[model samples]
Each structure stands twice: as C-alpha cells, then as structure tokens.
Target chain A: MNFLSFGHYHHDMCLVLHRSLQLDNNSMLSFTLAMRDGQAFDTVLSRAKSMGLAVREGRLLASAKPVARAFSIQDPDRHWIEIILEN
Target chain B: MSNSAFIPPNVLPPLLQKFAPLLKRKWFRELVLLWPTLTRRRFSNKTEDYGVFKPSLVGHFGQLAVYVQDIARSRIWYQKVAGLTHSRTSDPEPHPSKPGWTLRACYMSAKEHDECLVLLEERDPSGKMSVPSGMSFFHFALEVEGNRKEDVFAFAAQQKRDGFHLNYGPVQHNSEPPDGDGETGGNVACYLYDPDWHNVEFCGAMDTIENYRARYGDKKGSDRN
Candidate 1:
C-alpha cells in the first residue's frame, strides 16, 4: 500500500491519496471547491487546460435568478469537480 | 424459529403476578385480555399530551470517504487539478470487513476547513474479492465564490478550447427544502462528473434555513394542502 499527500500552501488544507487493489469506478460522493471570486475560478480553469485536461463551463440559476457561473472537470478517478463563481 | 413460548416470571408486575399462571392456559388467556382495551382507551383520549422526541443537530457538513481505483493518479489529480491539500495517510492494516486482506487510505482537505475527503483502498493476496459496485450516498456538494458572470463565460470558453463541455446548468432555482417549510431563496449552480462518475456541483448564493419560518409564517406545505 503506497500513499502520497498534497498540501495547499495558501490554505490550511491537504488531500491524501492512497493506493489500493480494489477498483470500484462508481462513487456516489461528490465535493466542491469554492473559489474566492471569478479570478480564482479562471485561474483553476486555465491551470486545468494547461495540463491538457478537459473542462466544462456553464451558468447556474436558482429560483429563476441567475446567480452563478461554474465549470466542471474530471479527476483521474472520474469524479466531477465543480468550480463556481457567484454573480 | 421455535414454537414454544416462555415468559420470565420476574418480568411481570406484582399486580399481574396472580394472572401469570392463568396466562399459560389458552382458555383463560382468551377471556382475560384487558391490556389491549386499556391501551386503546388511553390512545383515544386525544386531550392527553404525548411529547415526541427529536434529535438536535448542528447541520454542519462533515467529512466524506470514498473508494478509488488508483491512489497515486487520483491524488495528483486532486492536488494539482482540484487544488486540494494533502493531509495524512494511515499505515496499511487488515481490512475491516474482508478477511485476510489489507486496507489503506489517505485524507485531504480544503483551506480553513476541517472537513476532509478520505480515499480508501483494499487488497487481498488471493484476488478473490471483487470491486464494490457503487457507493450508497447520492452526492455531496462544495460551495464556491462567484462574483462576476463574465468569469463563468470565460471558464466555458477555456473548456471549449480544451474540447470539453459543461454537463449541466448555469440555471437559477428556488432554494427551498423539499418539505416546503422554509422561505424560498435563490441559488445558482452547475454540475459535472468526476473520475468515478460522481456528480459534483458548484453552487453560489444559497439560502439559510433560519428565515424560512419568518417569511412563510406557520403555513407549512402540509397546511396549505
């Protein structure tokens, strides 16, 4: 069993990765990362593209009120990562 | 599984002790059934107050644990792409449920948040166990900041350049609970899929549950009906 950890310097956050033999590609869990603003959101989108990753961008409405702009990307395990900027 | 019935004599109240022996007799049991009638009489008296208990909860989002195929690839994708920081990894140990197997896992978190994401893996030397079919939960969400609309468009444009498409949203919705007791506020959100086909959502401007009562008064959805 091998593992690695990644730390975000600007924030007191970290993610740990573990290696296992069991492979279940189906997961019911999803998580979100809030960006500071549109700029921060764009930075992540650009970073994904620079890494040759695919990204999806769209708008979101709440009760018919346009309140956010967001994008989606997939991690290596096929989990959806949604990045949102509020209007 | 057994036809015989047994009652511990000590469990009967002192007043009912005299009747305990008679209970074993089928004919006496049929004629002496008073408990059901008493129970129905008590229940029919609606004037009596019967307090129900509910749990007190803070309603804070906590940690999520997930199983992944490849820990290293998923770790780099989350750290580099998702921008999550690495926390710690646990030493390999025997699987909690699977015998003769080993288990390992790692934890990750975002800035300023104690809530974490745990990735777990399991291995067996015989390779007899099959991968899990899916997780039980429907989905979990993370909130992000959104200020300007143009940034979202820019993000979409970037994705288009990278040959990707937004799976859903850029829509507004009523931030109302399904029970219809809370005040309906507005929220904007979108969706995407992760490596394991998990549905991830990005949302902004969510409503708080506190003001729903004041705004809607005592008229709950059930009351309206």
Candidate 2:
C-alpha cells in the first residue's frame, strides 16, 4: 500500500486529504482538496499550478464542518481519477 | 581522486543485491558507483545537526498558526482564557509598491512538544476580517491546572461567566464520556470561541493531572473514557 493513502484532515495545515490513488511505476497522480472556506480555494489553486500539476477534473460540493463550502479539483495523472464532495 | 576508496558502501538488501554485480560492468560500474557517494557527500554538507536543532522548531512541529484580522482582541482572549502566554509579537512583512501593511501578531505556547502558535493579522487598509466557523481552523486547548473532570468543568463555567464562552459539552450534557476505564475513569470538557469565533476546548479525564500526563505525554490519543 502507498504511504500517502491515509487521507486525513490536518488541522494545522488546514487541509483535508480527500482521496488517494496508487499509480504504476512510471506515472504520477495529483488532485486538489476542497477548502472548507470558500475564500481560500483560489489561493490554494494558484499554489497548485506553480507546482506543475494541471487541473484535469473538478466540481463543487457542500460541507458542514465549522464553515461549509464545496470542493473542486482535477487529476493530472494518466488514470484521470476524480474526487467529489457533496452535502 | 584516483583511489578506489571513494566507492559507497554496498548496503543493498538481498532483493537489491543483483544491482551490485553491475557495478563491475566496466563503464557502468565505475561511473554509477561513484554517483551515490558523491550525492551522499553533498547531502551531508547540507544536513543539519539533529542534536543541535533549534528548540523553537523542535517543540513546535505540529503547532497551529491562526491568522486573525484583529490582533489586539485575539491576543487578549487567548491570554485571559486559553492560558497561553505571548512569546513574541511582530509586524507583518512590508509590500513593495505601497508603504506596506504591518502585521501585528503574537506567539503563544503550550506544554510538551507542541508548536508555539503564531496568531497574526495584517494591519493594511485592505486587511480582511475573520469569519468564525466550526469548520474553520479550530483553536487548540491549553493544558489546564488540574486533571479532574470538575476542574475543567468549573473553568468552563467561569469562562462562560467572564464573557469568553467556548464550545464544551453540549447544553444537554450528552457529550460526557461513558464511564469505567481503569485509567481514564471519565471525561468532561468545555468549549468556547475566541475573538475570531474559532472553536477552542478544554477537556479532562477523571484522574489526577500527573496520571493523565504520565499516560499521554503531550501527544494525541484515542479518548479512553
């Protein structure tokens, strides 16, 4: 199993690891986690782009933690996996 | 530079042992063998002395940094209720075009190896305000004076009266832990909001402070009670 499979919400980092996928030896996978705060999403996306990962698929879904907002993102790997958050 | 002594140690396990034979494959063996050792030397030069690590970074590994829009209000609330003390307060980094917005903030510490929290706010005209949400970054609880359930409960009550209420037990008290752990005994907690409305809590097991400390040394654990 891949070590990164543990999808957890780190309070300090303010990030939720929504999903994980193990890739073949020569491939890479990248997806975005939705922000609970609507305002922080754009800032997070900009950071992701600077890392050379592209947006492959994304959508908005509602959440109910402390504040509620939708998650959206894309996978940059060849498998083209998707993650969705729904209220 | 001509000596064979520069070769890296052959530390591969049985499964990787096959790769060692290739080191003697003429051009491949001589060229690739030195690469790992060269990389090791460069890495060693840049490595930090683990024993000499800064104390601030050592204990503050997992500490939270909460950026608030209002610095003064957040500082007062954390000091008065959360039992955290300021380590330092500083201004924000300046901008190039404008005169620059000042960052007014303070650092607060907790016990054990937890990181010191750096509460910050930008003092620029464009500075944004904080919106409290249960889902937002939660405020961390400080270790309280006693470990008993009553002490935490009482402190929670006092906070409520002092106008610094936090989210603790539900009004119905349904949140109390079910009893009878050999160590835990029971659980009680209190919760409140900071100036920014971030959720903060103080909780205790029905045991001595020393007992709890001995059992969980400033690390997260499954709720025993």
Highest-DockQ candidate:
1
**Per-residue lDDT for B155 in model 2?**
82
- Report the C-alpha displacement of residue B215, candidate 2, in angstroms: 14
Residue-level lDDT for B15 in candidate 2: 48
Which sections of candidate 2 miss by over 4 Å?
Answer: A1-87, B1-62, B94-102, B111-115, B123-135, B170-187, B206-225
List the DockQ of the predictions in order. 0.06, 0.02
Off by over 4 Å in 1: A1-87, B1-55, B124-132, B146-165, B175-185, B211-225
In angstroms, give how far residue B155 of model 1 lies from its true place. Answer: 6.7
Interface RMSD of each: 19.0, 18.8
Candidate 2 C-alpha lDDT tens digits along B22-129:
332334433553675676631111111112122111111223445454556667777788767766665555421125444444666665422245565544557743
Q: Per-residue lDDT for A1-87 in model 2, tens only?
A: 001111121111122221232322111111223343333445555555677666433321111122132233344323222222222
